[model samples]
Target chain A: MTKEHIVSAFDRDLEGIQATVMKMGGLVEEALRGAIKALETGDTELAQKVRKSDRSVDELDLKVKHDAARILALRSPTASDLRLVLSVIEISAHLERCGDYAKNIAKRSIVLAENAQIEGTVPALRRMATFVLSMLSDALDAYIRKDASLAEAVIERDLEADDMYNTLFRSLLTHMMEDPRSIAAGMHLHFIAKNIERVGDHATGIAEQTIYVVTGALPEDDRPKKDGTSITFKPSDE
Target chain B: MTKEHIVSAFDRDLEGIQATVMKMGGLVEEALRGAIKALETGDTELAQKVRKSDRSVDELDLKVKHDAARILALRSPTASDLRLVLSVIEISAHLERCGDYAKNIAKRSIVLAENAQIEGTVPALRRMATFVLSMLSDALDAYIRKDASLAEAVIERDLEADDMYNTLFRSLLTHMMEDPRSIAAGMHLHFIAKNIERVGDHATGIAEQTIYVVTGALPEDDRPKKDGTSITFKPSDE
Candidate 1:
């Protein structure tokens, strides 16, 4: 093949893999939103739908990984091209995990539907999910636009998600302590909140991949993380 | 360079990456063991030490990834050789996350040390950790020896971990419900159990990579997953 033709083919291959990643990202976002909506409305049907859709997300992720590896073997892409392929693999993996978290949330929503709503937990969780959803969208946009600053912004926004989660954690604890009967429901809500928090982390991971692809190095390891639930032994009321 | 010399160098490069992965796996296992010991004994110092040691694991993971990328770019390995390199990258990533879960357990252990013990949670968590540690070691051994059957066995063993986690989940909830004062400690123990359960999942992921490296395709997605916590609203008490 002519040199120009070969280079063009390689570019097309990279674009194809990236486009699939975007499609996968869209499915994940849909799944996240659908899961939260189901949680809010106690819609078991919607939750089941979200759970079923995750298989498509997983399939797309595998396709992206396989395509990127093929390009790595065939094109022998170097420098930024190589980084792009590696970053795509990492990004797709992160997106797939996010999809799994969404599925977990859906599963919990299905169960939580039968139980009495834990006071205000669902609305607070919805807000947190909304924030994390924005971060996922911005992270995907940063990858597509090659905008490092936007990716960095997504990383910084994770602090906000953490803060929201902590607030929810304290409130859920208070609700459970007041009524032991809500213990199971509160625990499920806590996991749902935790799942949303992890989605934010995965979004930040996607942002990091973008920064890596652009600058050829990951940002400093000391990214801001305000998650304190692991160390929190006392509810704020105490 | 002679063709034979180049081939030999590629083999050396692959070996170097694999050795680093084993080293990373060792560090992860140590961290898991230390974290459980700290939890069982309420040894805050050991917990702190386990948390500190995770940075080394992270650094080794970065080195392995960089070495794999360098080999891919320079050697342009294809077919099985390329799969080996990709698998190393994935295996290292899984090991790194397992390290993170261990660190989380350590962090929680530090907090739990100050609280009254939550009945039998610590011993149960330790048993679960031990089981997960074995799975991790076997997964690493499988990777080194290219034993797909051993890796498959590790994959099957995750169901037992999930079953153990479910038992812990119910017992912890019962304790919290019986005595509202233990809610904080119960939550912390629940998270610790969850962390160990995730370690098993990561080990299974490593095994899947080994399988992919050996067989060129991932196993079916319908592996045994008995983690019913997300779907269990009654806590086995109702």
Candidate 2:
């Protein structure tokens, strides 16, 4: 191959790898939405479908890794090119993790569906899932467009999800406190809530990668993570 | 600069990055042990210490990425050499995640100590924490030596930690059910337990990277993941 042909071929390889990552990202967003919808509606079959489809997500993860590795070795792209290759690898992994969290949510849906529905819990969780899915989709768009502001915007919204989780966790606690019957369902719902919270985290992670890729700098570390605060409480003397 | 000098410089760069990864791994192990000790003894001071030290972990993560990217750009390593660099990048990220989990466990310890301790729970968690730390240390050792069998051994031990988590979850549930008083503490302990469980997962992730680096193949997928199984229970009618 001529020198010109080789350069064009490298560009094509990078583009192809990125396109695969986008496809994987789209699938992951769908899985998150589908999982939450299934849980909200007690659609066990849709939950099962979400769980089963993760195989393709896993396969895409491997492909992204493999192709990125090949590009790194063969093309020896530098600067922004190198950053894009590395970001593709990192972003692909984050997308895969989102896929896993979605699968976790879907798996928990089966159990939640069988048990008594915890009041107000499903709707809160459904909202959190939708919010994070939007963040993820936006993060993917920011990555594709190399829009750092959009990526930072996604990061800024993470604390909102955390606040929602803390509220939901306490409400579930009060529900269980009022009625002993809700404990089993409460525990499952709590985990599902936690799973959705993690989906937000992974979305933020994708945005972080995007910021790093665009500016070649670390994302801001200003957000004070108020994570374990939700678990703190006044010791009720029984 | 001669090609030979450039090649030797790449070798030195790889060595430096690997050494940094080892340092990060050691710190992560210490953080895990310290976090668990803090929980075991209700030492809020030590918990704060573990959380404070994670900044260094994050810095090392960035440093590893920087050095690895430089090697990829400047040297263009081949075959096993490329795999080793990629593995170092992945393993460093896994170690950073392990550090994050340790920090999370420590953060939750403050709440657990302030509130009433669920009877017999801290000791169980301490044991699980110790078990996972040993696995992490062993996994790191295996990575340094490229010992596939030892790495696979670490992977095999993950289910042990999972079983421990399942048993502890049930016990915590039983405790909460028997007395409304234990609910707050039980919930905090449950999250701490889950964080420790995730530490095990990250350690296994490092081991999987070790296996990949040594064998140039995916780790065996024979072990069935029994996760999300702990949430399944027959709800007792109140």
Candidate 3:
């Protein structure tokens, strides 16, 4: 092949890898939705399905990373290409972790199904999941369009995720205190809330990587401040 | 300058960046120890000290990333050299987050001190901190030596950290159930344990990066899995 042809071939390879990442991300988003649906409806079968799908998520993540490494070694891409490969790898990792967070929620849903009911907290958890799902969807959209503002918007939602989590944390504590029988269920619910909160974090991570890929510079000064909400479970009624 | 001289200068730049990473790692290690000590002793002043120190860690991380990017752009490092630069950036990010985890522990320590006492979980949290600190130290050494075995060892320790966190988790639940007054303290302690657990996770992440840096191929098959322990909380006596 001519030198120009080889360079074009390298671009094709980078494009192929990016397509794989989007596919992987789509699967992950599906799993997150399925996990949440499983939880809301208490469907063990759907929860089991979500758990099983994580293996493919893991496989896809490995393929993306390995393919990116191959490009680095074979193409020896220049600065911009190198950044693209690196961002793809980082974003894939984030997506895989998001998959794991979903699987974690599914596992908790199974546990919660067998325990005493704490139905009050379910709406809050669902809202948290819905909000995070939108953040993730938008994050992926931002990546494709190279939209820094959209990415920034995705990151800003993380603050809302945190606030929602803090509210859930206190409400769960109150429920547990009111009925000791619900403590086990409460703990599992708290963990599910935490898992969803972390999904928001990983999504923000994707947004950050997208920012770096688009802009040569990191967001230095105006990085959004994380909510310093206390996780301490003090009931207001106390 | 001769071509050979230019290559040698590039090597020196890479070496300097590696040293900077180690310095940042050391500072993070110190911050973790300080955070743990402050938490264990309920020393709010020491906790304040750890929180203040995180700024230096953040600054170091930013400097490392910027320097690495310059090397990528200006020096145009070879494939292997590029991998080294990228690994340094990823590892530094991990270390900076490790520092944040410590800072978070410090922040929570301040809140815990003002809450009612829950003395039983302290020693367990201390042991968990000590274990994760050793894991991080070893992982950094593994990176310096390019020893995959050492990295694998560090990765394996994360299992133990997870087990320890689970134990601490169960005990905390028991305490919360036994004494409602301890709920607030128990919640804070649980958060501390979680922060420490994430430190172990970040250490494993560094070790994984080290393996990739040494071997052209990413470790595909023998990847250390997070322990799939049950998240269901149950009282020991029950």
Candidate 4:
């Protein structure tokens, strides 16, 4: 085959991979929202949906890898084409883990919702989850569009999720301290914040991978600053 | 260069990268143990040591990547050799993150040990840390030796650490419930358990990478059971 033919073939494979990943990302995003809603509204049906949908994410993960490998074996791509395949595989793996974290949150939400008193800090948990989901969506978009700048923005936004998680944990701890009866619910909330923080971290990982795929260089850690309302990403070089 | 010379050069480069990663792993293990000791005995000096030594691990990470890239550019390896280099680069990244987690734990230990009365959970944390360190060590060994079975064993052992973390979190929660005054300390301990759990997850990631490098397949979820004791690895037919 001519180089042009190979390039086109690889591009088609990558497009397929990206489409599958975006589909998976959409499912994970829904799962995260459903998990939080399950917690907020005590919707066991939503939690069950999140649980059942997790298998689809996992199956998509395997399919992406299988298809990527077939492309590699048949085409024997080189250089950037090869890196793109590897990055897709790694990115899909990270996204699958994000789904797993969301599923964990859904399971915990079910438990927390079952409790009678509702003793935990709910608003902080919701805020953190929202920030995490936003980051995930932005990061995936940046990857699909090869938008290094947008990926950098997603990386910057991760700090907001982290800060919110920290605040949520502190609030939960305080609640448990004031009323020992809040321990079970408060601990569940802590796990939820932790899962959200991890989702944000996975989003950052995706952003980093996007940067690598686009520029072949890892971006330096550009810590975002908190201004009470939202965290702003300021690149270190800037 | 002849194919034989190129192969030898790649082998030497792989060995060099493997050596640096193992050194970094050892340093991280020491840092994890030091952090636990600092928390258990309130040793700020030890925590300081861990925090300071982390820079060396970061430096090693950069050095490995540079060496791997240089080898790739010079030799232009194909197929399995290419996969090996890519896996090394990715594994090094994971190892760097593990080092970061250990440093974070040590930093938190300094503040937590200052006022927290930690009595019953220190041993569990230490034990879990030790288990993770061993798993990491074995995973590295499996990579160097190209031993898929050994890598599988390391991956299976992660369940033990997970169980320990869940139990530790529950016990700490109960303690916080019993004595509201211990809330801050208890939360700190909970974070420590979390760090250890993350360390185990990183180890598992490394093990999976090792297996992938050897067998060219990703392991299924295979999370450890909840008993904190034994685990089995069942390879998927796909």
Top-lDDT candidate index: 1
- Give the clash count for each candidate: 0, 0, 0, 1
**What would the per-residue lDDT of candidate 3 be over residues B46-137, giving only the tens digit for each residue?**
98899889889999988887787677667666567767887898899899889888888888887777787686687898899999999999
As a whole number from 0 to 100, the lDDT of residue B17 in candidate 2 is 90
**Sort by TM-score, best first: what order?**
1, 2, 3, 4
Worst 10 residues of 1 chain A by lDDT: A229-238
> Who is ahead in TM-score, 2 or 4?
2
Candidate 3, which segments miss by more than 4 Å at Cα? A1-7, A221-227, A231-238, B1-7, B75-80, B220-238
Best by DockQ: 1
Error of 3 at B21 (Å): 1.7
Q: Between candidates 1 and 2, which one is better according to TM-score? A: 1
Instruction: Quote model 1's TM-score.
Output: 0.95
Docking band of candidate 1: medium
Better of 2 and 4 by DockQ: 2
- Greater-DockQ candidate between 1 and 3: 1
Candidate number of the best TM-score: 1
| Per-residue lDDT of model 2, residues B66-166, tens digit only | 99988998888877888899999999989888888888888778777877788899999999998988999999999898898998899889999988888
How many pairs of residues in model 1 come into backbone collision? Answer: 0
For residues A1-238, what per-residue lDDT tens digits would candidate 2 score against the true structure? Answer: 6555555788899889999999999899889899898899889899889988888898899889889888988988888899999999999989888888888888888778888988788989988888888889899999989999999999999999988888888898898888877787788788888888878888888898889888987675555463644344632210
Better of 1 and 4 by DockQ: 1
Measured against the native two-chain assembly using Cα atoms, what DockQ does each of the candidate structures obtain, in the order listed?
A: 0.61, 0.45, 0.30, 0.28
Q: Give per-residue lDDT, candidate 2, residue A89.
A: 91
